[model samples]
Target: MAGGAAPPSTARGGYRLSALNDDLLQEIITCLPVKEAARTVVLAKRWRYLWPSAPLFLNDADLPQPARDVVVPRVLAEHRGRFRSINLAYFRLASLDRELPGWPRLLADKRTQRLQLTNRNYLPPNQIGTLPHIPADILRCGSLQNLVLGFLKFPVDLSHGVEIFLPNLRELTLAMVIISGEDLEHLITACTALKTLKLTSLTPKRVHLRSRSLRCALVGLSRVEDFAVVDAPLLERLVLYLPGTGARVKIGYAANLLVLGHLDTRVHQLQIRDMVIKSGLKPNTMASTSTLIPSVKILAVTVNFGVLSELNTLASFLRCFPNIVTLHIESVLHDPSVSASAIEPSGEHHAKFWQEVGPVECLRSHVLEKMAIHEFRGDQDEFEFLKFVAMNAQGLQSLHVVLQEGDTSSSDDKKVNEAREKLQDLRFQTGISGVLLVLPKEGILSTLQKATDLTYNDPFRF
Candidate 1:
């Protein structure tokens, strides 16, 4: 009476997938893609009830489009067990007007722990008249531990204190979410258990950090004039990447702050404690211990080697962190339109500039051990800087030179070999033989999102 003979598992030496217990089967089903997970019901008689019984892990992106409208609602409605996580990033707010109202309540009732809702195909705020705001009730979901929202407007009433509390939330990432500065601050404070926060492409006049639980924060590509850390006792890493015009960074009472940067000399003006870093400030003018932030062991900065003033400014910046052991330098290309005074002479003149720049404290103190130069183009100015660091950073153990990818010059075998040879000569002369590494630019070079990720200690290293 067996249908179509016994399954292959019926053989003496074969194993049966259906033999696994319900709990294990459900867990395995949860690991599959949403659509594939749903298809498990047809595998065997035991799996008929498994898909609906397992906790839901639904991602609209996982399902092929053209039918997401029908599939999403059906799954949400039919699933009998708790909701584990839900990501609805493929639909615009206007298209989900009717269904959106019920989502927050359903997610809350089903105990969803992680939720990401984004508005797809949304235009920039300036180009569009107004964006539809996310349902305010979504903020009331107490079971959420991680939330990522993008291309939507936060509730306008948040600034007026309409009672927002996310006591269990741990990680929050907001990208292109239109919200006022006060509301952003209010929302951040409401999350009493927040640990990691990332904000990108959102303009707030000023961002003031005053959180006790926050550890790592990244703000990138935003038009924020001032980023002030009023008080973050537990904060460790603060990364600011591609900041807009007139951006100023002020650090206040971040006692545990260790990792910082991509501090661009052309854009940002940094102020740590009472010390203000500025051009024309001599690096050798450190008369008091209070002027330096010695606790910072890792630093990343953007420097344009062609700019004479930027190099001088970078020298001053480096002197502020005398104990930094790891340094990351991103060499930006020269802008032909930049003021003539900022552009320095090339070839021999650049070598002369580095020679006269005096001893960088971190390099001479025998504390610097690791350095990575990104976007290396085998230019004279770059070589001059590398030669200075190699010769002066006596304690340097490793130097990583990352050649620019897809660059015609970087692909030239002769030029690359010449660069390698020169770097090898410098290494041998400095007694740091076998410490130089020439690498090509590849992979997903670190992003602000990944940089602020709590898992990595030195996000700027790559």
Candidate 2:
């Protein structure tokens, strides 16, 4: 038969692919997504069963109930190998509730390492599809390393006798989910090996995280009133994006909290105890005894560019994190459509603030390796901020300034150019090895001839 004519399926593009061994065919199929890989069945007889037989990554989330009932079960039944993953983005929630009790059993048996049950159904604004009880057996999926469930609300309090057995769950992301404070803590505690936890838009009054193995956490845009790190010894990287919330973050108990990225604008108290920041006098926010940042070396903070004209707050902050080696200042550009706030003329203090001063009291003679300011519009605020950094940061090897967008005429270009000239013109140059001006969106606003001068020659030398 091979010597004569090929099968109808392999008569055209099929034969070339079928010529490869099973491993090669599977390698090719693995590169394609689940649906596309399944579509390969029509190519050749060898593939008809191969797609169903391979370690399944079935994504029949969009299929209708009638078709899914037949196709999903049929493929699942025929497949002999364990499933690699399953993504159920869209499905009949009511029907899944009525049936699909064995969903957990199937996932546990198939060894689903990653599962994403994201519901993208069209719904009203601010409305999330509540998830029914996750089959308790699913928690038994010890091999499941990553879990993503969006637009879901658990029926009951997970803390009330609910014991999670997912021992290997390393990363868990829950968005638009209704979980209470105690329940969230309980769920986090359940995942014995959980390292990274991200919660977005979750309505929890208080979230107490106490995990020995927790490393990184991102809590964003949530209605969390109080967030305390009860005990996360291994926690290194923590990001809080509480854009518009009155949430307070307390992290004095944590021993090794290093990198913190905070974006919340609310004047919530940030306490880091057992660490002396400023010795004598303190920033107004410092309620307790002043202690410098104990372990934090990298800090990323978001600031409204319009309000940065005064460097008093930033100066006070740098005093707290005196050992900050790499500082990322992300400027939140205000919409010009929004009416600009009327600025009162500078006061007597303003004259003193603007005058060429010695190194900032906090940054004076300190080894600030690099200062990166995003959205560096050369306005009164940014100009003053840049002058303060350039004059204060003694060991500043590189000054990386990312200019903000401007009136389509490349004000990014204009601002970058002007700022560069101003920095060079500044009489104060302590550790000023180089002055760089760049566009935040674009990399740099320099010429082909002088781009090297703006780029960092040795960022890691320190």
TM-score of each: 0.88, 0.78
- For TM-score, the strongest prediction is 1
With candidate 1 superimposed using the best TM-score fit, by how many Å does residue 5's alpha carbon deviate from the native? 14
Please, what's the RMSD in Å of model 2?
Answer: 7.0
lDDT of 1 by residue, 1-462 (tens): 376566576855446766678899899999998899988888767688998989999989897778787788778877998999898888655545565447667888888899988767778667543766878778888888999998888876786956675788999988887888888888888888999998887857788888889999988745888888888899899888756665878888888889988888877888877777776554344424665778889999988887666777888888888899999998887555667675564546667777777677899888998888888777878888888887788788878887765664434878877777877777523477433345545554356546777677788766
Model 2 per-residue lDDT tens digits across residues 1-462: 878887776787555667778877876776676658878989877787676656777776546646765566566555776778777776544545445546667788888898877666635545544344455566678789998877766647677765577999998888777678888888888898988887777877787888989887777645777777878998876767655445666675666776766533223345555432221132233422354555776676665534423233444455556666677776555434545553323334443553533334335546566667765555556556566666566666666666544522553566566667876776546645345544325432232112112133222111
lDDT of each: 0.79, 0.62
Q: Cα RMSDs of all predictions?
A: 3.6, 7.0
Each candidate's clash count:
0, 7
Candidate 2 residue 8 C-alpha distance from true site, Å: 20
What's the true lDDT of residue 281 in model 2? 30
Q: State the TM-score for model 2.
A: 0.78
| Positional deviation of residue 129's Cα in model 1 after best superposition, in angstroms | 4.5
